[model samples]
Structure formats: structure tokens, C-alpha cells
Target chain A: MLKLRQGQAAIALVCVVLGFMLAVQFRTAQDIRSSIPFQRIEDLSQRLSQTEKERDVLLKQVYELRQTTGAESATKESENIKMGAGVVAVRGTGLSITIDDSKRLSKPGENPNLYLIHDEDMLKVINELWAAGAEAISINGQRLIATSEVRCAGPTLSVNNTRYSPPYEILVIGEPQTLENSLKMRGGVIETLQFWGIQVSLKKQDIVDVPAYKGAFRFEYAKPIKDGGK
Target chain B: MALPLVGLIIGISLGVFFPLTIPVEYAKFMSVALLASLDSVFGGLRAGAEEKFDNTVFITGFFTNALMAAGLVYIGEGLGIDLYYVALLAFGLRIFQNLAIIRRYFLRK
Candidate 1:
């Protein structure tokens, strides 16, 4: 009884504060309930716009690439492009290269074959020239296409299924300096071929002629899948 | 007890009608402090029932306990730990114990 008499005022004051807290908490909870749905809608709309912006950027990139090649808008131009794909003769500023047998005779008891350029050697040169941004390449007079074949035939080399004896003249149409530098860079294809004692020469020209690919193309198994846009 | 009940009713009505704008960040602090305050009120009730309540102790404990609980929550938030759970569990347990003692006081045989 004495304790209650002394503590009554403080106890009432403390209870009032507690009750006030409870009421505020109740109102805050109600506010949270109303705000949650709005937050979710805001988040979803933000995601949708972000995805839409990404799609717009990709579509713009596709449009820019198509404009450069003129590949998508007109079918006749695209067909002409397909016809000219490593064929139908194209002329541009480029480099002319000649790779021949080594000046030295074959080593004692070593195969005479090792001193001559093989199909793989020619293939390596073609691949390197292409890597150096060569737009068109031909070995001797035979133009190289996607289906062109290079192989050994007795003492001669077969290109586009036609055999020709070297000194091989490879004509390439592209940025001549870049192509020449790519070859002349130490530890590259030209260096390796030179180390084998093979003779190699490169000349830049303002106008280089590459004959049309005369070989036939055969597609046996592959076909492009149709797109809805087409 | 009658005076406390009357004061609580008036406080609750004032809270409901006053429309005070407490910031969202302070909500966790307020909640933890409120839990500590609730524990103190229940403790006071239990102590009064047992004839051992002290005015000065109850008043000081009211403010100090609430502040300490809120400070603990703020520190825990800064340290990236959920230390409010410690205050919550401690106060929650004490409130229940006080309620049980207060109930026993009323139901004593």
C-alpha cells in the first residue's frame, strides 16, 4: 500500500507513454500495408522500361550493321553479294605475293619434297592474308572461295581443282600496308617460311585483279531456318 | 491502477488524433524503445501488486530503458548486426513474466 502510494504518479505517466507508442505503431503498420502494393508496382514498371531500353539499343545496333552491308532491306542486292562472295571477280587496291622453292638444293638424304611449297603452306599463307584483312585472294589464276580446294598433285599444286606449277603468285585485295606488316612482323608466317629457305616477295599495288571463282558450289546438308520477320 | 488506466486511454486518444509525422528511419528505434517501455510498465504493475514499487526507480527506468533499447538498435544497425533481437527477446520475456506475476496476484488462493 505504501509502495503504490509513492509510485502511482510515475506508473500512470509511464503507462500513458506506452499507450501512445502502441497507437503510433498501429498507425505505422496501417501505412506500411497501404504502401507495399504501390512499391511493387513501381518496381515492376521500372524493370519493364529497363528491358524495353535494352531491346531498343539492340534493335538500333542491328539496324546500323544492316545499313553498312545493305544486307537486309533489298533481296536483289543481297543476292548480288552472295554471287560475289569470293567469286564474280572483284578489283581493289591490295598486295601481290610470290612464294617459290628454296634456292638451296635438298639436304643429303633428306626428302626433296621438304624444299617445295605444299598445299598446307599455301593454305597457311592464304589464312594469314585473310587474317590481315585481305578482301579477296587467288593462288596463280584460280580464285579461292568458301568451297575452293587446295591439294598436292604430283609435282604441281591443285587450286579450285585445277593444277598449277609455281612460282605461285597470290594476289590479295585489301589494306596493302597492314597485310604486308602482318606478314613482315618477326615470328610470323613470312619469317617461318623464310627460315625454311623458301623465297618470298610482296608488292603493293593501286589496282590488283583477282579472277572470278570458276569452281561450282554444292550445299548438301545445311539450310537456313526461316524467320518470322522475313 | 484507475489513474494509470485513465491516463493510458487519454494518451491513446491523443496518439490516434494528433497525426505526428515520425520519419520512417526512426520506426525501428521507436519500436524497440516501445517494447522496452512496455516491459517497464508491466514490471511496475507486477512490483506494485507485490507491494515493492518505487516511484523514482520506475520513472528513471522508464526513460533509461527505452533510450538504451533504442541506442542498442541504432548501434546494431551501424555494426550490421541484428542486436535489436536481444532487446526484443529480453523485454518480451520480462513482460510475459510480469504479466504472469500480476495474474497470480489477482488469482491468489
Candidate 2:
């Protein structure tokens, strides 16, 4: 009976230790699943890849938007260039001037040529309008550009190589009051022309139209420098 | 038999209540120790059924086997060898053999 009782006590002690170790080992395995660095690293890598994909998609969209806006801006720039080159007709509030030869007979010893409107008089009037900030100008439907010419073609006046007899109509686009003041200033172009008995009339209009340059542009001697030049 | 079962239940509850934890690095040694203790328990049961149970042998074997298994695992890790597999195989076979013997003795009774 003593032997049996001793055996029972030993077995009971061993069983207690065995059960405690089993519980602890199970708990430790659970801890590893929750706290291990390898599992955490795997999760973080997955999130990083997802974020990178989203960034790449957004970058592609940005490039596409820039491409579209770039094309739109290019067209807008070319339109401005054409307007400044006098290749397009324009209209705005401005002044109109009509000038012709004097109808009165010349006095004795007076020069009759002074009573006629000369190309130099027209050039002086145009220059004054330009100085007063004319956006556009035309004479007898011929637009004035950088290459336009105004000179005496025999008895008639020539503008942009086209001849026109008086009375000449000059259309200018600008502030009407400013342009009128510029032309009518003391000892200005209009005052000089009126002293010679030349007929000159100035009128302010709500809208003045200037036609495009009709002459063709030929580049025979000049070429645009490549690579924006040195 | 009933007393040993009650002791086991008490031990599990105690382990559950305590918040003691081992380091992650020593987890392999703990597992080997656990296996060794389990093997000793079954060996003791078999000896008892055969009428040859010794309290001193049973208690000493329980502690020594657990310590030896843990030491073997530690040495295996330091040497970059898998010596724990040998301990595991030995313990697993012994547990089964002891279980079989206990089952036969109980069947005969």
C-alpha cells in the first residue's frame, strides 16, 4: 500500500509539470504569430507596393493633362503671332481721316504743289498715329505692315504698291480721342497740311476695320537661324 | 489515477493564471523540454502498470531528461546542426511504446 501511494505521488508531480509546460508552449506559439518581425515585414511590403502603384497611375494622368494643355498653349501662341504680323483683319474703336487736293485756285506767286496732298504729308500723319499707340492701320483697304510702302506713284499715291486717287481714306484702330489730339497738336501734321490749303477731315468712329496684308511673303535672301542662334 | 489527473488540471490552471513568458530565441529549447517531460510521464505510467515504479528514478529522470533535451537543442543551434530532430524522434518513439504498454496492461486488468 505504501509503494502504491509513493508511485501515485511521483506520477502526480510529473503530470503537473507536464501540463504546465504544455500550456506555456502553446502560449509561446501564439506570441510568435502576433509579434514576429517576419510577418510584420511581409505586411508592410504589401502596403508599399500598393502605394507605389497608385503613385504611378497618378503620374501618368499628370503627364496626359500636361500634353493636352501644351498643345492648346501652342495654338494660342501662334494665333497671337498671326495677329501681330498683320496677316489677320482687326476691328476696334478708332479715328478715320480723309484728305484730298484743295479745290480753291492758287494765289499769284504761290506754289500750286503745296495745295496737293503729298506722300510725305501722309507719312507724317501715319507716323503720328503710330506714336499715339495705333493697334492697326489701313489706307484704301490696304493694311500697313512692316514691309508696306507708301510713296507717289506718278500723279496718284501708292500704298502697299496699289495706286489710289484722292480722296484717300485712312482707318486707324486706337483710342479715338488720343489719336485726334496727336494729329491736331500745335504745328502737327494736320496743322501743316491745312496751312497749304490742303483739304483734311478727321472723324472719330465707334468701329474701324483694318484689312489683312494681301502681298505674299517671299523669303529669298533671309533664313530663320536654327537652334535659336548663339 | 484520479489524483494525478486532478494535479494535471491544477497545474494547467496555474500556468494559465501566471503571465510568465519565455524569450522567442529559447522557444525551440522549451519545446524539446516539453517533449521530454511528456515522455517521462508516459514512462512512469508504464512502469507503474508493470509493478516496477520507483519514485527516485521517476523524479530524477523527469528533470534530467528535460534539461538534457534543452541542452541538445542549444548545442545544435550553436553548431548549425539539427540535433533536436534526433531527440524528438527518440522521445516520440518512447512515448508511443510506453502508451502501448499501458494500454495492454489496462486491457489485461
Cα lDDT tens digits for candidate 1, A1-230: 22244466677888788888888987876765665576467547755875897799889867777767564546655656864576678889999999998875665566777778888888888887886668889989888887788898987999888889889999999888878876865346776787566899999999999988876767789676778547
lDDT of 2 by residue, A58-107 (tens): 89867766777778767866887887789999989998999988886665
Off by over 4 Å in 2: A1-69, B1-109
Question: Which regions of candidate 1 fall more than 4 Å away from where they truly are?
Answer: A1-72, A75-80, A222-230, B1-109
Model 2 gets an lDDT of 0.83
How far off is residue A211 in model 2, in Å? 1.2
Per-residue accuracy of model 2 over B1-109 as CA lDDT, tens digit each: 7767887987898778779766555778999999999999888888887888898999999999999999998777656578999899999999999989888877776
Candidate 1 recovers a fraction of native contacts equal to: 0.54
TM-scores, each model vs. reference: 0.45, 0.46
Candidate maximizing lDDT: 2
- Among the numbered candidates, top TM-score falls to 2
Candidate 2, position A88, lDDT = 96
How does each model score on lDDT? 0.81, 0.83
